[model samples]
Target: MADAREPVVVIGLGRFGTALALELAERGHEVLAVDRSDARVQALSGQLTQVVAADSTDIDALRQLGVQDFYRAVVAIGSELEPSILTTSLLVELEIEDIWAKAVSDHHGRILRRIGAHHVVFPEHEMGERVAHLLSGQLLDYMPIDTDFALAKIRPPHSAVGVPLAESRLRSRHGVTAVAVKREDGSFTYAGQDTVLSHDDTILIVGREADIERLVTRS
Candidate 1:
């Protein structure tokens, strides 16, 4: 659990916002949850540090709740573009340290960014991408290390089996570096020229997206 000093304000009382607030509270952050519905506020009152029934789009109401100085504020209003935009704009005007807003589409994300949201999250799209990757056999896992680089776990090709790292020329041909390898016997091997690929071995590779895809599809 995290320390309680970190403070967060969550706008909206929908499932997504409520879940985020609850998770932050569980991690020991002081969370202030706000919504326009009294029933929604009542439902989550005991689970958070503060739960208020007020329109987040109202700047005066937000100021009254001390939201101007929050460590971070999240706009989790789903499907409602008007409230989401208003809330994001209010957070920026308040000069909160960080602002995270959820967008249902790429167009919405662009609008949120234009309004000074520090981060725009597409939860539904990202979740779909992860599920699609999991269903694809070649990729065991995929994680973006940076804008242009990725770290991936992949099964070795049949031709790579029994070949030493130096002779495979994976780095030269595929532009990827094997960081670690899990052998068939369950022993792990860090990157070394002497290491030989074994059948059923899972290798961790770091490289650009296209190169990683080429390595995964290589025969």
Candidate 2:
């Protein structure tokens, strides 16, 4: 397993890159933020482990910054497609084990993947879809695990509130599995066949996105 404190290099100082860098730092990871603009580098100088004003596409600059030593890197140059692809390609060439790139469109994402980006993300598109899902249902939280699978948090439905998992027939009726439950006392526990849910409890269910949506709509 990768060390939890492994340093991460974030190229670009766009909104996505800045947010990712800050969040990583908040989670106790050492983040090296790089950007071409001096102002952008200075803005995060006090927050991240290190901040540099240098072009990521420059192999020499990257090597000088010790980016080759970092196991993970993120190319977040949105709106600047060429730089993003070039940065990702350089990381791949440097044998960075994990390379995540932000792509503005399908074509951009395809190129990033083809050039060896381990992960390609469309943050705007994903956030929009997530908000749409939350707006259309009573789901308290919705997290997509993959193309079809998702984990949903919701208040227990009337039919499930007073029954144990074995008797609730949730899987049989809704095609969803109750993975965990959060009691009224604000504690969470794994849900089992013998676990009974209270009306005020919250449940985390896992299933196909369609199935979870169906269950969410019912509640």
List the global CA lDDT of all models.
Answer: 0.85, 0.90
Candidate 1 per-residue lDDT over residues 1-219, each given as its tens digit = 323467888898788898899998888788889999999999887788699999888999999999987878899996899999989998999988788999999899999999999898887876676567667778989876665688888887665669888888888988988889997778666968878887778888899988987777774
**Candidate 1 at 170: error in angstroms?**
3.3
Separately for all candidates shown, the number of backbone clashes (residues 3 or more apart, or on different chains) is: 0, 0
What is the RMSD of candidate 1?
A: 3.6
lDDT string, candidate 2, 44-116, tens digits: 8888868999988899999999999999999989898999999999999899999999999999999999999
For residue 186, what is the lDDT in candidate 2? 81
Q: Residue 185, candidate 1: how far off, in angstroms?
A: 8.6
Compute the lDDT of residue 182 as modeled in candidate 1. Answer: 95
Deviating ranges (above 4 Å) for candidate 1: 1-5, 144-149, 159-167, 180-197
Per-candidate TM vs. native? 0.80, 0.94
- lDDT of residue 188 for candidate 2: 77
